[model samples]
Target: MAKVDAPAVEERQKGILGWIEKTGNKLPDPVIIFAYLIGILIVVSVITDWMGVSVEHPVRVNEDGSPVVEPARMLFRSELIEHLLVRMPTIFTSFHPLGYVLVVMLGAGVAERAGLFGTAMRAAVRNAPRFLLTPAVALVAMLANLAADAAYVVLIPLAGVIYAAAGRHPIAGITAAFAGVSGGFSANLFPGQLDALLFGITEAAVGSLVTDWVMNIAGNWYFIAVMTIFYLPVIWFVTDGIIEKRLGKWTGGAVAGSSDADDDPDAPLTAGQKKGLAHAGLAVLAVVFLWLFLTVDLVELVSFGAVSVWGGNPPLLNPDPALEVTQQLIPFFTSLVAGFLILFLAAGVAYGMAAGTIKTHRDTVEMMAGGMKDMGYYLVLAFAAAYFVEMFNLSNLGIISAVNGANAIQQSGLPLPIVLGLIVLFAGVLNLFVGSASAKWAFMAPILVPMLMLLGISPEMATAAYRVGDSATNIITPLMVYFPLVLVFARRWVPDFGIGSLTAAMLPYSIWLLITGIIMTIAWVYLGLPLGPGAEVGYTLPGAN
Candidate 1:
C-alpha cells in the first residue's frame, strides 16, 4: 500500500468533506433530528408491523417451549400512543444518562461557575513544559473517561484553551482531547462502569451457552491497558504532526480568557486564588479519602458503621475475597459519577470560598443551579433522544437489523479475522445511528457473542471488537449525545464553527483510531493474547460438540 501524506490526503478529501459539511449543516439541529427520528420511527413501526417483519429471539424462550422472537410493534397505535403521550415526562426523566449528567453537573457547575475549574486547568497547563503539552492533554483526556461525561464537558474545552494559550491551533487541541476522550474511550488503564455494563451482557451471553460460566468484570483490563499505551502515540502524532500542521496557526481571535480574572488570559493568580486552589486540592483529597473509607473493604471494621448510615454495603462490590481489587470495588467504580459530584462540589465550594467567588452560601447554591441551567439544551436533546431510542427498541428494528447482520456474516465464507473486521465496521456504521454503547451491545450480544463463540472467538473478544468500533465512530456521529455539546464548546472559541466543521475536524481522528483499533484487534486475536485478567481470546462452550 502506498503511504499517504497527511496534507495531501486531507487536500484530496476536501471536496467530499465540504459536501458532508454542507449537507450536515443544512440539516436541522440534533434535537430536531431526534424529534424527526421519533416520527420516522412511528411511521416505520407501523409499516413494519403491517408487513409482519420480525426475528426469532436469540436468547429468550417462549412459554410454550418454542423460541421467543420479537416482532415489530406499531408506535402509532393506541397503546403505544398512550405510552408516548401520557408517559412522555417519565420517558425523559428515565433516560439513563440524564440523571448521571444532572447529578455530575450540580457539582461541576459549581466548580465551573466558581472559577475553580478554569483556574485549576489553566494553572496545570501553564506549568507544563512546551514539548509535553500535546501528549499530556491527550493522556489526561484518555484517563478522563473514568469521569465519564465530565471528560468531554471539562477536558475538551480546556484543551482548546490550553493549546491556544500555547500558541497552537485551538482546534487541534480540541481534536486531540476529543480523540482521547471519545475515540480511545474503551482504552483506559482501569476498568469502570463500562467494564461492568458490557461484561454483564457478556455474562448473560455466556450463560446462554455455558451454564456454569462466571464473568469477571475485569475481563478486558489488560487489553485496554495495552490499548491505551498503543493509542497514546497515535493521538500524539496526529495532533502535533498532522492536525496542527494542516490547520496552520491560531488566528481565531483571543483564546477564551479566565472566566473569573476579569477576562484576562495572563492575569497573575491572586493570593486568594492560590489559596483557593490549595483548598480545592485539599477538598479533593478529603473526598477521595471519604469514598475510600466507605467503599474499600479493608476499613470495613472501622467504617462499617458510617457506611451503613449511607445505605450500607453496595450490591456489586462487597468484600468478596474471590474477586479482583477492581471487581471488589465495583460499587465504587459505578458510583464514580456521584463521587465526581461530591469531589467537584467540595472542591468548588472550598475554592470559591477562599477565592471570594462564593461570597455567600446562596452563591454556591446558585452556581449549582447554574450548572443545570447550562444543561437546558442538553435536557431537551436527551428527551428527544430518549424517546427515539425507546421507540426504536419497541419497534424491534435495532435487534432485527443486528440479528440479520450477524446471520449474514455467519453464512459468509470469509476468514475469521476478516469476519471480525467486518463486524467492527458494521458496528461503526450502526454507531452512526445508535450512540449508546451499552444499548447497542444489549441488542447485539445475544447474537454476536454466541455466534462468535461458535466460531472459536471468546465473548471477551467480541465485546472488545464491539468497543473498538463503538468508540472509533463516536466523534463523527451527530446523534451522539455529546457531539453537539462538544460543538457548543468549539463554537465558544470560533463563533462560526458549525456541526459540519466539528465533524470534519473529528473525521481524521475517527479514521486513524478505527484503523489502529482494527489492527490492534486483529493482532491481539492472531497472537491469541489474553483479553483480560482471567479471560482468553478463545472460548469453549460447555458441552459443545
Candidate 2:
C-alpha cells in the first residue's frame, strides 16, 4: 500500500464537488446543530412575541365565523424552564421516532448479527450476468434496508469485489450500492423502519390540525415502492453507462487490507448457511400467514362437533361496513411496525438456530441488546430533537409560522405541483447540512405538514416529497453519517479514494435521482395517485368547507 498526499487530493478537487466538500466539512454535528437552532428559535420566539406577530388560522375560526388568529408566545419565561426540566423525560420518551426505530432495530439487529442479512445480499449478486451486475447490486441495496446499518458494512464492499470479479471498476460497484442504500434510503419495495419513523413524526406534526390522525407506518408504501422501481434504472444507467466508462477498467491487483482468501466474491455459502436461509424463508412465510389470518376472515373446523366456524372480522378488521375500506383497515395498517419486529425476530432466530449462531435463547437476547447499544447516539440526538420540536410547539411558533407560510404560498399563485417540486429542492439543499432524515423531518414536519394541509395537500404527499429530496442528495454530502465509512470502503480497493473521489463518482446518481424523484413526485400529485393504501395526494381539513 502507498500513502497518498492529502493536499494533492484536496487540490485536485475543484468546482461544485470541491465546494460541497468544503462547506459540508464546516458544519457541526447534527445534535449540536439542533441545539444551536433551539437557541435561535428561543430568540425568534421572544422577538415575535414582543412584536405581536400573528397569523389567521386556515381552518380554525371563532364562533362568529371569523378566522382565528394565532400569535407567537414567548419561550424565555419560567414555564419554559419548567417544561425543559420537569417534563424532559416525558418529552424524550414521547418522541415519535424513538420507540418506532428502536423496536424495529431490535429485530433487525438480531438478523444482521446472525449473518442472515449479509448472506442474503451476497447470494443476490453472487452469480449475476456481467451486464446485469449493476441492477442486481442496486436492487439488493434498495431491499437491504431490512439489514439496517449492516447494508453499509456488508453489501458495499462486497459489491466492489463482485464488480471486480466481473472485470468492472470496483469503485463503480461501490458507487451503485452506496447510491441505492444511502441515496435510495427511503425507497423500498416494502414498508420498513423508515416508514415507521417518518410517519410517526407526521402523526405528531399533523396533530395540531387533526388530533385523531393515526400514523400508518405504511402510509408511503406505494410511493416508495415506485421510487424503488424508478431508482433502479437511474442507478443502473449511471453506474454502467457513465461511472464505469470514466473509471476505464480494473487491473488485477490485491485489494488493500484484504487477503484473496477473504475477499473472494465467488465464495459459496456453507451447507449450514444454506439450511439457515431455508429456515428463514419458512419463518418469513409463517409470519406473513399469521398476519393475514389476523387481518382476513378464515374458516376453521371444530373436531368435537364436526362443525365449521367462520372467523370473521378479526380484531384487525373494522366491524362497521359503512366506512371506506381504508378506514376499515386502520388497525392492520398500524400493526406493520410490530409486524416488522416479529418478522425479523422470527427469521433471525430461525436462521441463527439453523446456522449455529444461536446456541441458546440468551444469544438472541444479547443480539437485541447489541442493537440497542448501536442506537445510543441516536437516543442522544433524539433527546435534543425532542426538545426542539416540543419547544417550537410550546412557543406557538410552529403553528404561527405554518399559517403565515401557507398564506404566503397560497397567495403566490404558484401551482401545487411547482410548490411540491420546490420542496424537493429545498429538502435536498438542507440534506447537505442535516443528514439524518428523521432528525430533519422532526423539525420540518410540524411546519411543513400543516402548512401543506392548509394549502390542500396531504401529509403523505408532503412526506413523499421530503423523502425524494432527503434521499437524492444523501450520496453527495459529506455530512451523511455513513459518508466516511463509504470512503473507507472505496479505499479498501483504491487507497487514493477520498471524499471528493467518492462524491464525484456518486454525483451522477445524485443528480439523476434528484431530477427523476422531483419529476415523479410532481407527476404523482398531478395524477392524483394515492401515496399509499388509503393515503391521498390531497387533504381537506374537516369542517373547512
**Leading candidate by lDDT:** 2
Model 1 per-residue lDDT at 134: 79
Against the true structure, whose TM-score is highest?
A: 2
> Where does model 2 exceed 4 Å of error?
1-12, 61-67, 253-257, 260-262, 300-312
| Model 2 lDDT per residue over 1-545, tens place | 23434435453468876777778789888899889999999999989999999877666789999988888888878988888899889999998888998989899989989989988888888889988999999999999976878899889988888888787888888999999998999899999988888888888888777777788888899999999999999999999899999998799653546764425677888888889999999999999999987876554322543433443457787868999999999999988889999999999999999999998999999999999999999999889988888888888887887887888997899999999999999999999888889888988998999999989999989999999999999998877888878887787787667777777888899999999999999999899999899999999988877
Q: Which ten residues in a row have the lowest lDDT in candidate 2?
A: 300-309
lDDT of 1 by residue, 82-140 (tens): 88788889877766556666777788788778877656655655556668987787777
Q: Model 1: which ten-residue window has the lowest total lDDT?
A: 1-10
Cα miss at 373, model 2 (Å)? 0.3
For candidate 1, list the clashing residue pairs, or say none. Answer: 57-69, 219-532
TM-score versus the correct structure, for each prediction: 0.68, 0.95
